[model samples]
Target: MNDLRIYIHIPFCKQRCSYCDFVTYDDKSYLMHSYFKALDTEIALNRQYIEKSNITSVFFGGGTPSYPDAKFIKAALNKFDLAEDAEVTIEANPGTVDFEKLSIYREAGINRISFGVQSFENDMLIIMGRIHDRSMAIRNIKDAKKAGFDNISIDLMHGYPLQTEEGFRNSLSSVVDLGVTHVSCYSLKVGEDTPLQSMLDKGLLPEIDDEKDRNMYKAAQGYLQANGYIQYEIANFARPGFQCRHNIGYWVLDEYLGFGAGAHSYYNGRRFSNITVLGEYIRSLNELKLPEDYSETIDMEESIKEFMILGLRMTDGISINVFSQKFNRGLYSVYGNEIKDCIDSGLLISNGEKIKLTQNGLDFANKVFRKFI
Candidate 1:
């Protein structure tokens, strides 16, 4: 049986963050019941795939999964025949969940909770338009532990407007002190059409300097590594044996099925995603039709390129033997010149069995990724 991973997107949030451009609705709480019904229908419609696969992971990612009732999460999970040790995770916001709600989620089989604690500084949180203050963030982390989550992850951001290197380090220290098992630190990017971009345009927020961003990134890497967290992926760090398996599956190109609005899926070399708009997703499901907006089969060349790009995201990099076995082509035969160029530029290093990014390459990851593209 195929080892399948499942992702369910909850497209409801109490409010949108300044830097977010994801497909989420801030005022759609009233549609919660109908949306859950549509999701259940979508799951039932995909029952054939579910039965033949050993569902190994389930992730509830979203606008704010904790904003809705935990029972809705349970309702979606009931449709799958999960493996005995599935890594079930839910993404939550700090201000939305309490001890009782989180405890109920634990009972509903959520083994991991990833909180969106962007920064521990109240000023930075305010700048980012986060709903929770630093105190609430700390309280939520403690409550997650009290509610029986041994595996916890929190996201921290750096390189944003008004955020100093010292402030970023302080946030990292606070997360480490919280004793969470995993940490994902992302550098803030001012995405186009986001409120952050508008602020930058109007000079309401200072433009982040490239050199400062790099320095902050290096600081985070150094601090986390010294504090017993292993840099398993470029942006993710974890204690021993606590790396996120679901995210690792994505890096390794595992077959995954995504449900609900705006969710994407990859199975048997085919890639597809559901409709992004909530109303359209619900309408299609209510009419007994699949809400797919796009689908395509990945060809050999595209697959090889994706393998290199995604696998290279991991700190351990890609295995040459596995690549050869999968594609029936030696890695060097196809991209020997590119690999040689990257190595000569000190962007990549190879110890014969595998190839991975060097520290400098991590700093210029976009430049390295562009080479493959």
Candidate 2:
């Protein structure tokens, strides 16, 4: 059987973060029951695809996956006949989960728990409109550990307009103290039309300092690596054997199916996404039709570009032999000039076996990625 991954989007949350632009709603709890029914219909619609593949991983992500009733989450998971070693993960916000709820998820077959603990700073949390304080974040993680979750990951956000270097450092130290298995540190992006963006527009918040942002990013790499976490992807660090398999599947361009409103899929040589509008999604799925709003066939040329681009996101980069084997074309034949340009600029290093980003490349990765396109 072919290897596959599945992603289920839960678009409900207690409160929306100020900087978030994802397609999630805080006032949609009333639609939770209807949405899961539509989600079940969508999964049933894709039953043939699921039957033919051995699903290796599943992820529940969203506004806050833990915000929903555990039964709905468990009911959705029961639909998949996953691999015995499948890595099932849920993206949880700090205040939305408790010991009993976490234990329910564990019993439902979720093996990995990724907490969206954006920061451990009370001021930062308040500014970001996060409902959880530092204490709550810590307690939730301890609760997850106590619930028998050994493979745990936490997300940290830095470079916000009001985030301080010291606060970021302390946040890193706390993760070490918690002894979680994985970490994903990311820089803040002020989404357009978001509350955070409005604050910037009204001069209520200061503009983020680019230099300080770079320093914080570098610090996370340095600090996390020193603390025994391997920087596997550009933004993700993990202890041994604990890398997020579901996300890695996306990076490597594996075939996967997605469910729920606004979820995306790359299956059957097509890239497509469901309707972002919940009503439309539910309506279409109820009619026994797939709720696709946008789709495109990934041709050879587009596939090559995506492979190189996504592969380069990881620290190990892409393999030359695998590229030739998979695409039946030499990597140099397709990206000879682009590769040379990145290497000449000291952004990428190519040993014949593989080509990966250099330390300098990490900072200017967007520039190097542009060369390939």
Candidate 3:
């Protein structure tokens, strides 16, 4: 049996950003007692999924996991059956973490910390409606290190409304200089129905230029790679042996359970998502029922399509042998024409039976991925 991975969503934030659409709110006064009870019940019901006592990774993502009280976090962690060496990580905002909370989380079995340091520029931080300034983020990093947390990752973003290439580089350099083990850099997307979309429509904010976004991404890749960080995923770079095991579990299509409002889980050929609305989530869970509002069991062709699309996102592409083993079919027999066509088009390369994206393919990754989709 494959080791199970766990994801716990902390669906609260000190404030909501302007360009955000994630299922989180700014209210601090939520039904904490009721929420934890529901979560505990869900955990007990789903504990049977961890066959062979195999639980390898646990990730705490947001709203902002660090935004809550430390005691609440400790209480929540006590419910799970975590492996001794499991890669336990918590997502944190800069100002939300302190030495005391860090100690508490570490004591509670969290060994990794991923900080949301979107930018090191004060102006950009304000533009993004982030609560922490550059100083607070830097201080948090130092304090975390002082608290004996070495395995750390930082999240940064590019292509903000008024961001420049120089400004982006400065942010990257600052984090790199801080000596984090991993970094995840993502390009800004102006999704439909987001506050950013409204701003763009009203001419309050300029539209995101695709070319500029591409340039920034390429620059990030070059700079980070030059600094000895390997690009494991398209948006994630890590020091040797320090890749995010939890996220890699997702990209590799490994089984994981999602617990919290708006969380999604995939296991036993089924994918289900919890309710996105907070009130609805609490209501369903409080009633001692699973909060799965949407679900789909992936089929053969859809599974293959997802395999190709997601596998290409990693620096290590898809393996024909692995595919063959998975489907009990020959790789050439199944994807011979498609593979040959992609290779001829200079979008893919083959190493033995493993197929991966070429540099050009990575640049136009969406197009390459869409071929399979």
Clashing pairs in 1: none
Question: Each prediction's Cα lDDT score?
Answer: 0.93, 0.93, 0.86
Give the C-alpha miss distance for residue 333 in model 3, angstroms: 2.2
Off by over 4 Å in 1: none
lDDT of 1 by residue, 1-373 (tens): 9999999999999988898888889988999999999999999899999999999999999989899998999878888888999999999999999999999999989999999998999999988888999999999999999999999999999889888988888998999999999999998866679888999999988899878888988998999999999999889999999999999999999999999899999988899999999999999999999999999999999999899999999999989999999999999998898899999999999999999999998888777888887
Q: All candidates' TM-scores?
A: 0.99, 0.99, 0.96
Clashes of each: 0, 0, 0
Expressed as tens digits, the lDDT of each residue in 246-305 for candidate 3 is 998887788899998889998888889999777777788768788999999988877787
Candidate 3 clashing pairs, residues 3+ apart or interchain? none
lDDT tens readout by residue for model 2, 313-371: 99999999999999999999998989998999999999999999999998888988888
Specify the poorest-scoring 10-residue window by lDDT in model 1.
187-196
| Candidate 3: segments with Cα more than 4 A from true spot | none
CA deviation > 4 Å runs, candidate 2: none
Report the C-alpha displacement of residue 41, candidate 2, in angstroms.
0.5
